[model samples]
Target chain A: AKSVSISVEGMTCSSCVQSIEQHLGKMNGIHNIKVSLEDKNAVVIYDSKLQTPVTLQEAICDMGFDATLAD
Target chain B: LQKHEFFVDMTCEGCSNAVTRVLHRLGGVNFDIDLPNKKVYIDSEHNVDTLLETLKKTGKNASYLGEKSAQ
Candidate 1:
């Protein structure tokens, strides 16, 4: 498994964090996910063989938030 | 009750739902989310700061769009 941090923009509330967690939680390959309102970011642990950082970024953007790789 | 307008950076129905659920759960607050316009009209007893803070919990950026007539 590999871990990646994504900086997200346009998040506003606890429900936003929970929504992100729930959506990402259902995706394949993601093993762990942490979304923080204070940090404005998400740390995702996933199997690289099944998902790419770009895919994760797109997934976040798809949900209405802007996202990019932290590093 | 007071009516408030806001510009919310929400991209999809899911985002709108998140906002709706969060605000509704707060009680004494009603929201009409205009997805295409990226705007929300809220009828609430709470102050702008409280509503703004509540919206922030959803992880979406929200900006006040001026007050409309009370309902």
Candidate 2:
């Protein structure tokens, strides 16, 4: 599993967080996800062979949240 | 009031609900609550420190991500 952290912007509440989590969880090969409202970021654990970081960013964008890979 | 982001460890829908209930009790209007991102945006007339403490009481880690100055 590859671990990557991402910074997300425009999230305003817990429900938004839930939405992001639910959507990402639906994707295959995602092993785990941890989000921080304070940091405006999320750390995801997934299989590199099954999914790439770019795919994950697209998933977040599809949910109406701006997400970028954390440096 | 200031806008703050918190980094938390939440695993499921239940966890998101738990955080929401606790935050609501503190008397702030949750402008945005996204569970997938583990983020909550609130417009409160109260101190943020108290709110952060409330989240901690529920077994979640929280911090002040920052605040947006009210215009």
Candidate 3:
């Protein structure tokens, strides 16, 4: 598995963090996810052959937050 | 433009903000977020499917509550 950290914007509460975690957690390639509202980012672990950092970032973006890959 | 009523599972300011951002990003849409009621009323040229799909992108549970008015 590969891990990626994505910077997320516009979340205001713990519910926001939970929502992202719940939604992305159900995806096919994702193994685990941790969303931090305080840190304004999501760290995701996934199958490298099945997902890319860009795809993860875009998935978060599609969920209405401004998401970008974090080095 | 037509007004459509949608029920989105919004629990707090963050949820409502997510709704706001997605609708705004879709463009050509004017909307009101009733966070307490978990309702979103959108005035747009987009079809019901398009609007609903857009709302679902927020990773919230969203359902169409039918049309409201023609404005």
lDDT for predicted candidate 1 compared with the true structure: 0.82
Ranking by lDDT: 3, 1, 2
Instruction: Order the candidate numbers by TM-score, best to worst.
Output: 3, 1, 2
- TM-score of A-chain in each prediction? 0.97, 0.94, 0.95
Summarize candidate 2's per-residue lDDT along A1-71 as a digit string, tens digits: 99999898766667667666776877899999887778998889999998999998867754445689866
Summed backbone clashes in each candidate are 16, 27, 0
lDDT of candidate 2 at residue A71, scale 0 to 100: 67
- lDDT for model 2, please: 0.70
Report how far residue A49 has shifted in candidate 1, in Å. Answer: 0.7
Error of 1 at A71 (Å): 2.2
Compute the DockQ of candidate 1.
0.07
User: How far is B23's C-alpha from truth in model 1 (Å)?
Assistant: 21
In candidate 2, chain A reaches a TM of: 0.94
TM-scores of all predicted structures: 0.54, 0.50, 0.91
lDDT of 1 by residue, B1-71 (tens): 55799888777665786677668767798778888999988988899998887776555688898887755
Give per-residue CA lDDT, model 1, range A1-70, as digits (tens). Answer: 9999999876767777887898788889999999998999999999999999999998776555778996
